[model samples]
Target chain A: MSNASTRNRGIPNPLAWIGAAALGLFGEIGRLAVFSARVKAAAFSPRWYIGQIWKQIVQIGFFSLPVVGMSAIFIGAALALNIYQGSGRFGAEQFVPNIVVLGITRELGATITALMLAGRVSAGISAEIGAMRVTEQIDALESLSASPYRYLYAPRFLAALIALPLLVLVADIIGVMGGWAVSVFGLGFDSTVYLRNTLDFVTRNDILTGLIKAVVFGAVIALMGCYQGDRSKAGATGVGRAATLSMVGAAVLVLASNYIMSTIFVEVGL
Target chain B: MTTPILSLQNVEKRFGKNHVLRGVTLDVAPGESLVVIGGSGSGKSVMLKNALGLMTPDSGKILFNGEDVTQAKGKTRARMRERVGMLFQSGALFDSLTVWENVAFRLVNSGVVSRAKAKDRAIETLSKVRLGSDVADLYPAEISGGMQKRVSLARSIISKPDLIFFDEPTTGLDPITADAINDLIIEQVRGLGAATVTITHDMASARKIADEVAMLFEGEIIWRGKASDVDNSGNPYVDQFVHGRAEGPIQPAL
Candidate 1:
C-alpha cells in the first residue's frame, strides 16, 4: 500500500492539469484583449508619429507588393486549372471564368494575401520588436519619456490598417488576370470572353467584402506581432519563440475572423 | 535637511515564488553619486528599475523629491521620466538609427528642436563623451562596444536630467576602457549636478565613482556607508565580497 501511494504521488492528476491549462488559456485571452484596447487608445490619442507611420506604410505595403503579386498569380493559375478539371465532369468548363472571379473576390484574394503577410510581415515585426525588448531599447524609450505604444506600436498598427486593403485590391486584379492567363492561353479559351465573364460575374459587394476582411486581417497581424514581441523573454531563444508565435497566432486569427465575418456577411445577404 | 532626490522605502518585488527584492530601502541626495554593488541575480537591477518606474515594486513608496510617484501614470509618469535618464547595459542604442539620431532622439521626438538643431546638439554631446563628429553618422552596430557605451552615455546626459541610473556601465569593456568610462561618468554627473544611482559588481568602478556605496545581498541592502569605508566595513559580507573570497558566508550558486 505504501509503495502504491509513493507511485501515485509522482503522477499528476489529469483533471488538475486540464484545469491549469484552461486557466492559462483564459489568462492569455484577457491579456490580448487588454493589449488590443491599449492599441486602440494609443491610435486615437495625440502625439502621433506621422513620419514613423509613413515609413511603416512604405515598408508593409510597398515592399510586400512583389511577393503578394507573385502568390496571387500562381494561386490564380492553379485555381483555374483545378476548377476547369473539376467542372469538366459536369460538362460545364465554360463556367471557369465566373467561378474564378467569384472565388478570388469573395474569399481567396484577401485570405491568401493575409496568409502570405502572416508569414512575412508578422514574423518580421515580432523579430524586430522582440530584439528591441531583449536589448532594452523599449526600456530606453520609456526612459526617454516616449510611449512605446505611440512611437512603436500605433504607427505599425495604423500602417497595416491602411496598407492591407490597398494590397488586397491589387491582389484581386492580379488574381483574376492570372486565371485569365491560364484559361485563355493554356485551355484555348477566348481572351475577351474570359475578361467579360469575370467582370460580369463579380459584384461590388464581393470586392467590398474582401477589402473589409483585409482590414480586420491587417489589425490581427499587427496586434499579434506587437503583443508577442512585447511579452517576449530574454535572449535569442525568446526572440525566436516570439516570432514563431506571432506568425502562428496571426494566421489562426485571420482564418477564424474570416470565417466569422463571412458567416455574418452571408446572413446579411452581402 | 534637503529631501532626497530619490528614495525607496521598503520596496519589495517578487517573480513567482522567487522573492527577488525583500523590502529594499535606499536613498540618494541631489548632486550625489551612489553605487550599488551586488553579485549577479542579487536584485540590484530590479531595485534600480523600480526606482526608475520601469518596474513596479510589490510594496513600496518611491518618492521623487518627496512626492510619492509610486503609482504615477500618464502625464505624471511622463513628466517624471523626462527629468530622468538611464545608461543601459549593452548600450541599447537604437540599431536602425545613426549615432547622432539616437543621441538626439528625445529632443526631436518631443518637438523641442528642429532636426538641424538636434543634429548639431547630438554632435556636440558626442564630443563631450570623447566621440568625434564623424562617428555621429555611423550606426550603433558600426561602432566598437566601448564606443557604444560612450554614445549611450552621451544620450543619457543630453537632457541634463535631474536623476540618472547607470546599469552595469562598465561590465563588458576592458579595464582601460572601463576606467575611462568611470572617469567620464564622474565628470558628467558633476557637470550636470545630477543625483545618480549606478548598479555594478565591479569594485573598482564603485570605489572610483561612488560617494556612498551600498551592498545588496539576497534582495536587501545589508550594508551601506561612505565609499572610503567600503574597503573596511567591518561586515563579513562586505569583506568577503570586497576581497572576492570563495569560502565566505555568501555561497556561490551551483
Candidate 2:
C-alpha cells in the first residue's frame, strides 16, 4: 500500500521485458555454441567411448523401429486416402499410388520419423543426463578424471546422428508398402498395378533427400537434448524442466530445419 | 619441508550474488584425516570441491602436494586426479552401470586393466566393503540406499588413491549402518595410508573418522583443532552447530 502511490498504474514495460527475453535467448545460444565446440574438441581426443556409443545405438535405433514403423504406416495410409479423394475430383485417381510413394520418399517419411524420435530419443536423453547432473553423477565422472562430455554426450549424439538416417530408410520402404496396402484393400486397386506404379514413380534422388533430412534432424535432436541437460539447474523440478525444454526445442528445431532443408532440396533441383 | 598432500590457499568462490566460500585456507598433511563439519549450506561442500579441483575458486590457488591445480586441466590435473577419489553425499553411482561396473569404473574407463580383470577386482572390492557376491551384478537402482552407499564407498577406494574426499559418508544410514560405514571408511583409508578430507554435519561421524575437525561457517573456517577437542572448542557458532542448537550465532537460513 505504501508503494502503490509511487508505482505506475498503466501498461507494463514491454521494451524492458522484450529486451530481457532477447538477452536470455542470446545467452542460451552462446552457451550452446561453446558446448558444441567442446563436443568437437572431444571428438578429436582419444578414448571415444565406443562401448557407450553401441549401447546408445541399440537403445535409440533398434528399439525405436516399431514406433517409427507404426507411424510411417499410418501416415502412408492417411496420405493415400487424402490424395485419392483430391485426385478423384479431377478424375486422376490413377495417380494415387505414384503420389503416395513420391510423397513418403521425398519428405513425409523422413520428417515424421525425425519428429517421432525428437519426442522419444531426445526427451529420454535429457531426462537421463539431467538426472545424472542433479544427482552429481556427472561430477562423479569429473572426480574420476573423465570428461563428462565425452563419457556422456558424445556417444548419444553419434548414435542419434547415425540412427535417424537408417530409420528414415526403413520408414521409406514400409511407407510405400502401407500406401500400396491402402490403395489395394481400401481403394480396391489391384495390388500388382499399385506396386508397379510406386516403383515407376519413385527416384533415387527422392530417397537420398529424405535420408539427408533425417541426418540433420538427428543432430538437432541430440544436440538440443545434451545442451539442455548439460546446463540444467538443481533438483527434480529442474530435471523435469530440462527434459521438457529439450523435447520442445528438439521438435521445433526439427520442424524448422525440415522446412529449410526441403526448400534447399527444391532449389537445388534434387 | 615435505609439502602437504593438499592445500587450499585463500580460495574463494561465488555463485551469482551468493558467496559460498570466502578466503578458505587449509592444509592436509600426508595420511592425515581432516573432517569438515558444517550445517547445510555452510560452504563445506564448496570448500571440498575447490580442494578437489572440481570447482575453480574465484580467487587464490589450490595446491596438490606442491603444484597449483586450480584450473584442473591438461596432464598435470590428470596426474593429480589419478591419486584422488570422492565419495559423493548422494552416492552418485551411475544408474546405468551395474555394481561391479560402477566399482571398476576408473580402471576400465581409463584402460588401466582389462575388462575381465576389472570385474574380478570389483568383486574383491565389494567383499572388502562387506557386500556379498550377489550384490555385484545388480544395478544401483536394484539395491537399497545402504547398499548403494556401500557400493559408492567401494568405488571410491577400489583404485586405492593416496588422497580421498568423503562427502557425508554416513548421512542417511541408521546408527548401526552409519557406524559400519565409518568403520569401512576407516579401514579403507588406513589400509591405503591416505590423507582424508571428509565433510559432514554428523558430529558422531566427525568424532569417529576425524583426527582433526574444521567448522565452516559464514563461508570461512571459523574454528579447527584436534577432533577430541570439538565438544569444548567454545566458539559460539561451532558450539551451536555441534550441539544442534535452535538459537545461536548461526541463524536458520529461513
Candidate 3:
C-alpha cells in the first residue's frame, strides 16, 4: 500500500513584502481622498477642530516620550565609540565630542529616530482606525449624527503632529548624553573637555533644523499610516497590508524629506 | 390606520451583475411591525439595508414622511438615522466598549445627553430587556450568546427610535431562547408603538413578530399578506421557504 501525504512547500519570496507595501500606499491615498470628500460634504465647527489639537497632544505627546528617549540614549553611546575610534586613526581623538553632536543632531538621532517611531506608532494608528472603518463602526457613527473625521482622525493626526517633535527632542538630548558617556568612559577623553567641545560645536541652526525635520517627519508618518489604514479594504488582510505599507512608506518619505529640508537649509545659509 | 411613514418605490440593487433587489417596492405604516421572510440570499437583508441607506438602491424613490430622501446626505441622512434603530445579526455591539457604552453610543455621539445620563438610560433599557445592571459593565464577548442578543436589543431600543430594523433577531439560539427573544421583540415594539422591519428566515420568529408578512423570492416580494395567512400562503415559493423543503422553485446550489 502506498500512502499519498505530500506537502507542497516552497520558499517564500522577500520581495513579496513590496506588494504589501504598494497595497498600503494605495489604501492611504484612497483614505486621504475620502477624508477630503467627507470634509467638503460636511463642514463642522472650528472649535471641534481645535479640540482635536489637544487630543493629538494627548495621543502623540505624552505617549511616545519613553520610547524616543530610550532609542536616543543607545544611539548616542554607539556613535561616540565609533567616532572616537575613527578620530584616533587620524590623531584627532579630541574631535570625537564635536563630531558626535554634529553627526547625531544632523542625521541619525533626530530624523532616523522620528522615522522609526512613525513606523511603529503611526502604523498602529492606521490599523486601529482602518479596522474600525471596515467593521461598519464608522457608518454606525454617521447614522447617529456623529462626524467620523472629527471623532476619529482629528485626534490621531493632531497627536502625531504635536507629539512626534517632542519625542525627537527627547531623543536628541538622550543621544548627546549617550555620546558623552561613551567618550568619557570608553575612550580616555577628559569629561570637562568633552562637555566643553560639545557645547562649543553646537549652534542654534543645528537644533532648529532637527526640530524642523521632526515636525515634517511626524506629519508624513501620520498621513501615510492613517491614509493607508483608513482606506484599507478586504478586512483583516487589508489591515495587515496597510500597517506594513505605513512603516515602509513613512520611512522612505522621512529620508527623502530629510534630504530636501537639508538642501533648503544649506541654500538659505542656515 | 396611520399613514405610511416609509415607502420604497421601484427599488433595485445589484452587486457586480448579482441582482439583489429587482424592482422591489414596499410601504411601512407608522407603528406597524412588517416581517420580511425569505430563504438565504432571497434579498430580504438587502432590502432592509437599502431601506436604511446602508446600501443605496440603484434606481428608486425612498420617501420618509412624504419627503423624497433618495439623494439626501450629511445632516439630512443623519437626522433620518436618528429616528431609527437597528439590531444586526451579529449583535455588532462595539467589542471595545462595555454593554452600557455600546447601548449609549448614539446618545454620546449625538451629544443629546451627558455621559452620566446616557449610562442611566442604558441601565433602564437593559432592565427593560430583563438584563440586570451587572451586565452593563461587561463586554459583549464576556456574555453568553443569548445575553449578547439581549444587550443588542437594549442598544437598539436605548434611544427609543420611531423606526427599528431587526436582521435575523433570533438567529443562532436554541428554540426556547429564540421564542423568548421573539416575545421581547413583540413586547418592545408594542410598548413603543414604533414601526419595525424584521428580516428573518426563521418561520417561527416571523410568525411571532409580524403584523404583516412579506415573502421574498428571486429578488422580489413573491407573497405578502397578514401574518396569520403565512401557513397557507398560495405562493409556491412562500410555501416551500416557510416549510424549508429542499424541492421547490428555489433551486439548491450544487
Better of 1 and 3 by TM-score: 1
> In candidate 1 chain A, where is summed lDDT lowest over 10 consecutive residues?
A38-47
Can you tell me the CAPRI class of model 2? Answer: high
Q: How close is candidate 1 to the true structure, as a TM-score?
A: 0.98
Recovered share of real interface contacts in candidate 1? 0.87
Q: Which whole-number lDDT from 0 to 100 does residue B235 have in model 2?
A: 90
Model 2 residue A162 CA deviation (Å) reads: 1.3
Give the alpha carbon lDDT tens digit for every residue of A157-177 in model 2.
888888999999999988888
RMSD of model 3, in Å?
6.0
Cα error, residue A89 of model 1, in Å, equals 1.5
- Model 3, C-alpha of B228: deviation from truth (Å): 2.1
lDDT of 1 by residue, B87-142 (tens): 99979999989999999999998897999999999999999999999998999999
DockQ scores of all models, one per candidate: 0.89, 0.88, 0.40
Which one wins by TM-score: 1 or 2?
Answer: 1
| Candidate numbers sorted by DockQ from highest down | 1, 2, 3
Better of 2 and 3 by lDDT: 2
| Model 2 lDDT on a 0 to 1 scale | 0.90
Order the candidate numbers by TM-score, best to worst.
1, 2, 3
Q: What are the iRMS values of all candidates?
A: 0.7, 0.6, 2.0
Q: Which stretches of candidate 2 lie over 4 Å from their true place?
A: A1-11
Q: Is the docking of candidate 3 incorrect, acceptable, medium or high quality?
A: acceptable
